[model samples]
Target chain A: MTTKIIYLDHAASTPLDPAVKKEMDAIKTYANPSALHQLGLEAKEILNNSRSKIAEILNCKPEEIIFTSGGTESINLAIKGIAQNKGHIITSKIEHPAVLETCKFLEKNGFSVTYLDVDKDGLVNPKDIEKAITKETILISIMYANNEIGTIQPVKEIAKIAKKHNIPFHTDACQAGFLDLNINADLITLNGSKIYGPKGIGILYKKKSIQLEPLMHGGGQEFHLRSGTENLTNIVGFAKALELAQKEDNNKIIKLRDYFIEKVQKEIPRTFINGHKKERLPNNANISFLDVEGESILLYLDHKGILVSTGSACSSEKLEISHVLDAIGIKHDAAHGSIRFSLGKSTTKEELDYVVKELKQIIQSLRMLSPIHLNKEEIRK
Target chain B: MKIIGYKQDKAWLYSNKVKEHFFNPKNIFKSDQELEDYKNNADGIGQVGSPACGDVMEMFIKVKDGKIKECRWRTFGCASAIASTSILSEMVIGKTLAEAKKITPKDIVKALGGLPARKIHCSILGDQALRKAIENYEGKK
Candidate 1:
């Protein structure tokens, strides 16, 4: 018999909500939203309704919302669209690869980017944004909440500063859907996959006045900001998911998260939580176990049918350490030992209890074979 | 302080053999207290890697009559590195000092079934530490 898997990696991507799936299944996938025929017009109306619903939740005009593939594309349009040529952009070191690599790609062009340092809690200072701004600085990009550590940034204050300087501001709120929306940003990115919506669907909300050159040069859709045929079914699913997410009491899920964190802190010795204690996402629990490599723990946990994730270093192409952990000043060696356990609304207390039991045993056994655990005096600093 | 350098394919991230070693690593020194005692009693010791690259291995051994009687290792690394060190410790014991000295990274890779291409360097860690311990033992003699 196959072991039942308990998924705890919701921050990476959440499962499709049954409500969303139902709504998506009902959508007719025949007519393109752009087609001028009777069915196409009907599709256009459906698409418009979905946009209005999402706009209502985000408190933005429906016309201002630009549909894109996902967080990465939204971010590319937000950053690269504004700073495509010869200017400076300011962003934090702890941003997702979508935002960071977009800035990096801009760096390859004529533009320059300043990667601001985050505090130990993975927060970007608003003053740093003000200090970094110059006459040439065009946009300031930061995330509403980090994906790996789940530390929420000071988006409101940073947006205020950016407004004071009249520089366009963008925040990738890919992982911040369950929380309140940060409405201060000129450009905001929201992903469907992270919020129980279908993958390959995302939103970019622009405040009408913000000018962004189109990334894709086709069909002149999305008011010339983003081109191509709109994905209506996934968009409807995305809207339904967001509507469902906003209606649910996230404090209940937060309670589950807190209980787990409390249990981990109380029972697990020589372990520490990575993100800010209070100012973090309700679902995130990034913890570091001293001397126990996270990948080994991940494999062992997988064997026991408990799913979790390490940083992108282990999961991605590069063998490097996690940029977020490194930015937060975690020692490289200790950073390799970090695990992110993101809870979901569907997560139950019994599942968490089982995880805690297995975790305690795993840590004990792994430490038994750990050389660093054995020679902590000389190796640990 | 890294890259004992062995060829491995990208597809094989971990083998069942590697998992067996990692889940129940052999001849581990257990705690820092035990490691301290093992260090004090060891006839030879070897060290490699640094915290910068997210891996470091330190090994200790006891040699009697030109043969390795005990082998123990401490490491800060990923799954493959930890498993490699554990397997190397078991392989070295009951072998002549000269034979232990001859164990290459490739031998460790072969024994572990196989490791990922990027993680093949981790096997080098075990081989280097063993080589270091054997050299230290010979140097003392």
Candidate 2:
């Protein structure tokens, strides 16, 4: 038999819920949502119902929700859709590459982008957003919660500021769970895979009156915002997934996550917790062990059948210093050694306890072999 | 043989051999306090890369009869870098300095059963640092 696995990287994506899977299997409507026949009507109904349910979750109108491929597509549509390759945009240094790279791409093509600085806790100050705005500024995009460090940004306050300045605001809520229960932004991006729903499905919540140019041009679907054949099965799965997600006992997940972080801090020496102590995602605990490269820890954890992420999924394989860690102003050692342990509803206390036990031993062993010893004077030179 | 299959482990960008050396790296200085013991006894020392750039490596050696008798290293890099350095330590033993000089990143990659395409840079670290230490030793001559 294969080794029993423990998954702790929910921020990248979540396991599909059996309930959602059964829902997907039960819905056998395969016609194009735009077709006018019976199968098409059934597919259209599924699409409408899913959109309505997700709109309810976001407390917005059904017309505001537009289906897309996933978080990256949602982000691209939101950023580029608004900019149309012109005007000023303001974003943070710690945003997902989807948003940062999209903004950078816009920059090279005759648009100005102001990458707002964040505090040491990886939080962009709302006041900083206000200062960066100018007459040429057309939109501001900030993430709801950081995918790597798990620092929840002040979305509503920033949104209020953007509203006062008459600039459209967008926030990538891929890491923000169902019920959103927290952030409120004009354009919010939601990913299906991050919520235990099927992959290749996501939504862009554009508040009524916010106009965005269509990223995909085709048969005038999705209110002309995103045009493509609807992914009815995943859409239906996402609706159920969101409903189940908001109903989950988040307190249990938070308790388990805190227990895990506390155990690591207590057992490991010289371990630094990245991100804000509070005001972070209840399911995330990102920590850095001095002298223990995160990739090494990740592989060792994998050896023990425990899974984790060194940083965001996009940058993990590149083995580069995390920009999120860098934006948090952590020292070079702490930044390079950072690892993220994201909890999900399935995480258990027993698993966390086992992780801490194994982690303590692994860190102790690796430190002995690492060159970053206690002799700091030599390194400083 | 499989490191990528637990929810999202396909991102495990490491070969099995690389995993082996990383989990159990070979000869290395245990700690700064212990390295104090070897402060004056080592023949040559070379340091490369830096923590600021996310990787740094240091190699300490003992030369005997024109051969590398002992090769101990310490590095703050990704798992691939650590594994490559560990394998380098094992490969340089009993080899003359010129033979050790002939060891390249391709040799390290071959010995480690091939690192991930992106991690090939890590293999570069140990060989470069070893060559630098040999140069440092030659300068003293």
Best by lDDT: 1
C-alpha TM-score for every candidate = 0.92, 0.90
Per-residue lDDT tens digits for candidate 2, residues B1-141, read: 222323334555667787678867888766767677765677778888766555678888889999999988887777888899999999999999999999989999999999767778877889999998888888887
Expressed as tens digits, the lDDT of each residue in A1-381 for candidate 1 is 223567899998999999999999999757998989999999999999999998899888999899999999999999878975699999999999898888888888888899999998898988888999999999999999999999998788888999999999999999998878845899999999999999999999998999998889988988888888898899999999989887878788889999998898788888888889889999999988887778877877776677899973643233477899889887766777789999998898888887888888888777766656423332223
TM-score of chain B of 1: 0.87
For each candidate in the order shown, give its overall lDDT on alpha carbons: 0.85, 0.83
Name the fnat for model 2. 0.39
Clashing pairs in 2: B4-B9
Two-chain DockQ for each candidate model = 0.25, 0.35
Off by over 4 Å in 2: A1-3, A179-184, A312-319, A374-381, B1-12, B29-41, B132-141
Which candidate leads in TM-score? 1
Give the lDDT of residue A248 in candidate 1.
79
